[model samples]
Target: MGDEKKRKMLQRIEELMSYGEPTPTIEPSLLKYLDEAALRGILETLERRREKLIEDEKEWLAQFRKEES
Candidate 1:
């Protein structure tokens, strides 16, 4: 994927992640138009984002427990 396309996809993914809920299925037309490379890039980026969110959540919970104690 080109840098600009990748950047746009990353921005969209981040926006979805900010919702803190599972992402809904993307529009069919959007998926239909994407080449395999773009799809793979999106999936890879999303997985990284998911991992970061999981780590952030764990840290937040640990801090909360410490404060409670």
Candidate 2:
């Protein structure tokens, strides 16, 4: 995916991760149009990237605490 589109997708994913949206918000029609492999790959990639971002955030907070102390 292109950088701009990928960034947009990540933004949406971040929002969805919160207690804001309903599960399985994807519509049936969109699913029908999507290629199964592509969709699965995108989802998996997003999931991994999100995990890494969370880990990085935690590390940053820990470092900040040490500096404060």
Candidate 3:
């Protein structure tokens, strides 16, 4: 795949993070792994990519559908 296609593939993973999803609940004992700021920043980046993927996918699908018809 070309660079654009590679970017598009990555967008699929990003799409999942953009939506509000329940975070993994950690037990009080494992709280050492918690990093709210890091998590938030990652989610912010994902949210942006997710939005773009959604738009691109819609166009991609529409074109496919039209071709099939």
Candidate 4:
């Protein structure tokens, strides 16, 4: 991919990492050398982690509510 496309993907990855818990940390310098497939893989892995975190949070909330009864 072109430099512009890589830059945009980097931005998206950064933005995704900036959100709530269970985020992965990667060095920006290392990311720049990777191809689009690698970048997408990273994004997909992070997305899966985020989904797991959300699921765990929902489970915790449900447990908490159950205990309040």
**All-Cα superposition RMSD per candidate:** 8.0, 9.3, 13.0, 3.8
- Give the alpha carbon lDDT tens digit for every residue of 1-69 in model 1: 555665566556555555665664454446446765876677688888788988999998887674543
lDDT of 4 by residue, 25-49 (tens): 5566775689999889978987898
The per-prediction tally of clashing pairs is 0, 0, 0, 0
Sort every candidate by TM-score, greatest first. Answer: 4, 1, 2, 3
Once fitted onto the true fold, the runs of candidate 4 whose alpha carbons sit more than 4 angstroms away are 20-31, 66-69
Root-mean-square deviation of candidate 2: 9.3
Candidate no. 2 TM-score: 0.50
Candidate 2 residue lDDT tens string, 1-69: 454555455445545454265564544344445454565566677778778988999998887674543
Cα lDDT, model 4, residue 18: 78
**Two-way TM-score contest, 2 vs 3, winner:** 2
Local error of candidate 3 at 32, Å? 3.2
Full-model lDDT for every candidate: 0.65, 0.59, 0.53, 0.78
**What range of 10 consecutive residues in model 2 has the weakest lDDT sum?**
24-33
How many angstroms is residue 6 displaced in model 3 relative to the true structure, after the best TM-score fit? 30
